[model samples]
Target: MPDARDKAPLLGLGLVWQQLAVGQRFRSFGRTVTEHDLMGFVALTGMQEPLFVDATHTGALGPRPVPGALTHALIEGLLLRGMVHGTGLALLETHIRPLAPVRVGDTIHAEVEVTAIRPTSTGGRAVVACAVRVRNQRDEAVMDYDVTRLLRGESTP
Candidate 1:
């Protein structure tokens, strides 16, 4: 993390959108997942799966697995927070593939690639496709998928 004195100026939404291009990639700052983060997500989403709630019940998958949705949300949030904070209009769709379990205390990073960009029927909006690969400190991929979002253009009306 950059120190306060070393921080760069924030980019505006227009400049952010202008920089989008297929094949461009970016990495969000890493975050260590905590038990509180996981439990809060479960409570907020009402995910009653034993795998997410009980660590004592050791199954074939071992201890309770952090909810996949929470992982996806965190990955997306990191990406947006770093590059396009307050710029996105709506998340059109998301598809997540969990390859490994994300346990508490694991520091994960989100790697994003701009896969596709399509202009919408309305000149003021565009569909952006981001391919996200989430990996832990060990560098093992925990999740991979694509997310589509609607981005507003200069014409907001």
Candidate 2:
């Protein structure tokens, strides 16, 4: 008989705080940015910049330059889905630096490296710091950021 554990849902659970270690690295699955994604984000955020909403307006990066905020949100979505999910408590801080422009149709993913881990003053929680690099389909880095998050410990409080 097959054990029920063998049939566990794929990617249904997130890594608890203890499972993460400094110097550990991971790559998230890729997501392609589409025109619809750009349009929707622009509409929702009210970011009506010509570079994002105007197809005819050509910026330094050329036409269809997606907003840097959109790119960051997409990468953060990937990280949340793939790494933190239910185990993440809160976002403590983030420092973002845009390296290059991301246009529609550019598939992107995050390369993450755990930089620090420290137990919180409260039991059953910890602070985790990570360096994230967002890259496009051409393997060009589009953004770099350091994220600090509060994660749940494996043990119940």
Candidate 3:
């Protein structure tokens, strides 16, 4: 008898590795940054940097900068519903560059582009490289990065 925890979800069959293509681009739905989101990130990741946690702390740098990693996660969450929509196999790596500051009430969107693809040596999976850019409501880039994900495929006999 299989436990419920061991069962895969109904949508488990994501886009197969072979169905992916390089140069494809996706735009994620917009998400607005909030105080709760920022604070929750502090609680979730133990990131208590003043730039993100200190409400009154403001400098020439603009509103307390939203944690870069949090921004990345939120923007990526939007992508997951559409751009990165699929049963993800694994996140191989993420390289991020914080370009600008994000603050409360800022609406953000992600632009994801498939950069490269290669089959795993076993021929049952593939590694996909994607370039992601997160932009604020002002149309300014807040963060940019590249992520590599492993995609599942049909099993070989």
TM-score of each: 0.83, 0.91, 0.83
Instruction: List residue ranges in candidate 2 displaced over 4 A.
Output: 1-11
| Candidate 3 stretches greater than 4 Å from native | 1-14, 83-86, 154-157
Note the residue pairs that clash in candidate 2: none
lDDT of each: 0.80, 0.92, 0.81
Ordered by TM-score, highest first, the candidates read 2, 1, 3
Candidate closest to the true structure, highest TM-score: 2
- Best-first order by lDDT: 2, 3, 1
Q: Write the per-residue lDDT of candidate 3 for residues 1-157, one digit (tens) a residue.
A: 8888777655524466677789987787789998999899898899987877888887767776778888988977776665435646778999999998888899999888899989889858888899999999989998999999887775631
lDDT of 3: 0.81
Better of 1 and 2 by lDDT: 2
lDDT of 3 at 126: 83
lDDT of candidate 1? 0.80
For model 1, state the Cα shift of residue 109 in Å.
1.0
Worst lDDT run of 10 residues, candidate 1, spans: 9-18
